[model samples]
Target: MAKIVASSPGKGILHGEHAVVYGKSAVAMSVDLRTRTTVEPINKNVVELHLPDLQTSSEWFIEDIMRIPVTSNEEIEDAVKVSEALKHLQTVLNVQVPCCTDAKQQSIYAFLFLYIEISRKYRGGNFPSVKVTVTSELPMGAGLGSSAAFAVSLSAAFLAFYGKLDKKTPLSQENLDEISRFAFQAEIIIHGKPSGIDNSICTYGGALIFQAGKIKEFLPEVPPLKILLVNTRIPRNTRDLVASVRQRFDTCPAVIQPVLDAIDAISRQSWQLLKEMSNTNSLQKFIPLLKVKFQENILHLLKESLEQAELEIFEAELGCNG
Candidate 1:
């Protein structure tokens, strides 16, 4: 039995949060933390999943999985049809996962879906018993895109194990694109409508600008940026947050629209400044870049640009506008 292992980096959004949902541009970079997954085909009759970070393990008998309704690839390709397919898949399977939480359940669902989909095309439904093990250095739900990394690594590992992609050429643009495509499908199962920033950055492993469905690769090589991360250890649902933003826009598009526009401008300006300042690989350039930022007050302009709209809104409400 062959074993395939793959790892993908998490992402941190530098600019554009709720705004990116509105088709505005956002900037994100791959973080140091990554999610790793290993897939091993086994002679046993059960499919297994082990998540070391969560201390979780579960298995489903191949007999039970085969009983689930089969949907053709064409049907699964449609979002609505696949969503319904999962509901059926969830109902047909009674696998009780130890340490089962909402997040774990979601991840499991995504894995099962991707596995069946890819396996159907690769091995023609002559399913084999497989064990998947996953580990992650990124904190879940800390806004660092733990799920995206999971989806990316899992998709890549499965593809490699099935010989759809050459593991040696994982860095090639063609391979990255295919890996990212499967990852995005898994993301839809996890997060209702992902901005694609996390999966793109995780697959590409560099800085990027994402807008709507388009991605502009910012840096071919990962830049050496020293960043500090702090987790508040609070539980927040990404779906709820996205829903709230959508609700806000529906209620007051005029207000939220300008804010989204401002954020897009900020993201664009940031990329421009970073490109202009550090066009070369010289370490000496960074010191001058930092100096120019503070000395010229470019940071001040960005801060004021974001806040100015709120200030104007309040002033207009109170008849303080001149």
Candidate 2:
């Protein structure tokens, strides 16, 4: 039983959040904050989970987990399959089905979901008894990719424990892809309709442009930018916010579609500016244009809906002097 440890960075949506749900382009970048998972083999025939961020710890007997019917990775392909699997786990664990309403429960479900899936996939019918511990520097439910980072780290740890990962060197592209795929499955269990951008950025790190379920990582020439991640301590329900946006789109597609299109344009422009900035040293020259475009296209659209203080806080978070 090898002791395996892995960590993955959280991510922030640089541009295009709700619009991405409508097949529009978006950009996400990996933040310095990370979630780390460490797996150690135990002599007992039980698997333990310790999550400091959630302030919970539990252990499941390997025999009990093995008693549950195992689904092949191919069988659990889509969200429906993932949901079905989650339902089965809920029955086995005697927990609530829709556990997302509780942060601690949701985090536990995600861990169990990933642990069962990855361990089953790699270790076959023989489940290993391991004590897995996780700790994170990321803020919970801040629209950052905390869940994705957790999933990625767990996937990597499980893979490493099964001797499927390279022990000597950095994870290769192939390894990253596999980790991302597993993390995406976990995301589906949590988010229901994740775009895969969060998992991709967490696995590969740096920045990426994602659109319509496709992701393109930033080129090496593009230097990573230092960013300030300020937690406003403001809490909002993502489902409610998404529903509100969907309602607006449903009611006025003619008007809202153009706003979404403008947002998409801004994202594309920002992407291009990033590329140009990578090639040249004069990054400041594009800041004004980018600011103007953001103000005109995005801020203008969001102005009426967001409170003045909230808007000001966001602007300040973006490092806007105005």
Candidate 3:
């Protein structure tokens, strides 16, 4: 009917960033930064997209998107799989892959998938006309959950537009969960099978423990800590980042698997420490917490070093600033 706007928080992975992709538990906390999306009906019979951060804009006739095809999860074809759907949409949209980075392509693909599939499911295949615009306070591709926040906000906005979400009760658990669910689906297209922690943090605006595609919410026990979020401004595709970690693990499972287990242990222990710190002034558990933090810190340093090796190869391929 009228214009709808929704926003979702960005997140910081306190522990288990790379390990989480391997189905290890991670702790994700919502950050101050967020992404906002607006969806409004248009009479032009076209679906328009505006991604200001990406400096990109496009529009598609509803007729064209509908003709691209739709199917249920159980009945999906190779092209319908979330991983392949973007390429399929790309061929249909006639968007040149050479002109866009993998990050940019995936961002556009996630949006288009959500718009087309969510609209089809919620508003029926009648091809509703709408314009969707996205604006973000988070730095793009800096690994601050910017993509997850974007997806969550886009999902919320589209759901609200199609009468699947309540504008007045956007904060309701039901609405938040629905937004998170759809955002995770979009995450699959972008991250190639995310752990669902980022979208959960963005949707619920709190701390979460996510593993094996299931997320558990934890109370915000401790006060917010002051920390700086550095945006290196180095353009890197998240999928590439994840793939690097996967490649390392795949190559050295004997050595790397234990490291991932250690990381998971660190996350679980830190989560417990947060809960303990929230309660009594007991210093007994504090030492263990410090130890866990120290261990995780070491792991993080190792991860960066490993990633640097991979990045050097990319630098040689794409120049310092591709």
Candidate 4:
């Protein structure tokens, strides 16, 4: 088999950040940046993983790792380090696959999931000892979906390695869906509640308009939306944000329900506007509407997670009219 080298782009949602989890639609764009993974075979029974971007590496004999039990209670860090799928491959193949370790936050788990899935599917002879390298230029965790990008790149690399990238023929829609589905499965190991948007956008680049249960990549449509992202170095926990929103629903339903309803409406309208832009070629006309609806929806969601004092600060930051 030929060595596989694959790369996939980073993605960001223009609307429906957290609200999408509650079955809202969101528009997302694939940036011209990516994570890359390269796989090369060696002569031995030990595979190695190297990640130079993060300046970290770890490796274990394939046989030694297989004996390690898979435990969900052993903390996310440790469980990911010694993934269940990796152990399965090690034990079944009865070989050593040493992983070169890296600090690329998501690389290890992505590699483990893809390796095991491929091994299970082929069920052929021993997989040659290989050297795998993951490298990326995108910021690791700035909410840019770097984790999903890395996972997709690794999955694509393995698909190419096994000569399965073109197994279904001329890039049909079904083939695209299959590729994206496979990538999404690998991403689950890294992102506990992935929306699947990241994996889909990275796997099939360009502009995507995604609904609660569907995703569509629009054709050559370049909208005039001047997207701006605000990063709060405040480092809010997503779980805590969700919990706070739930608490509002439980404790102050009368006050919060209207806001949530309005936000949901905004998300729906935004999705329609994006779809319209894709069809009409009049993207400039909807730019202002897109900006207003997107900002309003996100601002309301943020309010659910903010303290009164923090809300005051946020209002001031957005200025008087905003």
| CA lDDT, every model vs. true structure | 0.75, 0.77, 0.76, 0.64
- Encode model 1's per-residue lDDT on 185-232: one tens digit a residue: 788777777778888999988788889966964676545666677799
- The TM-score of predicted model 3 comes to 0.84
lDDT of 4 by residue, 134-253 (tens): 888777656677767777787777767777677553446665665676576665555545567777778777777665646744534545556666666664433344555556556555
Estimate, for each residue in 245-320, the C-alpha lDDT of model 3 and write its tens digit.
7787665576566667877887787777766665667656576555668566675553765665556567767885
Better of 2 and 3 by TM-score: 2
Give the clashing pairs for model 4. Answer: 47-97, 47-98, 49-100, 57-101, 58-101, 62-96, 62-97
Cα lDDT, model 1, residue 257: 72
Candidates 3 and 4 compared: the better one by lDDT is 3
Positional deviation of residue 190's Cα in model 4 after best superposition, in angstroms? 1.8
| lDDT, candidate 2, 10-104, per-residue tens | 88887888778788888777787889999998899899999887788999988778867766457546676677778788777777875555667
Cα distance off (Å), candidate 2, residue 243:
4.1
Worst 10 residues of 2 by lDDT: 300-309
Which scores higher on TM-score, 1 or 3?
A: 3
TM-score of each: 0.83, 0.87, 0.84, 0.73
TM-score of 4: 0.73
lDDT leaderboard ranking: 2, 3, 1, 4
Report how far residue 147 has shifted in candidate 1, in Å.
0.3
Clashing pairs in 3: none
Pitting candidate 3 against candidate 4, the one with the higher TM-score is 3
Candidate 2, residue 212: how far the Cα is off, in Å: 0.5
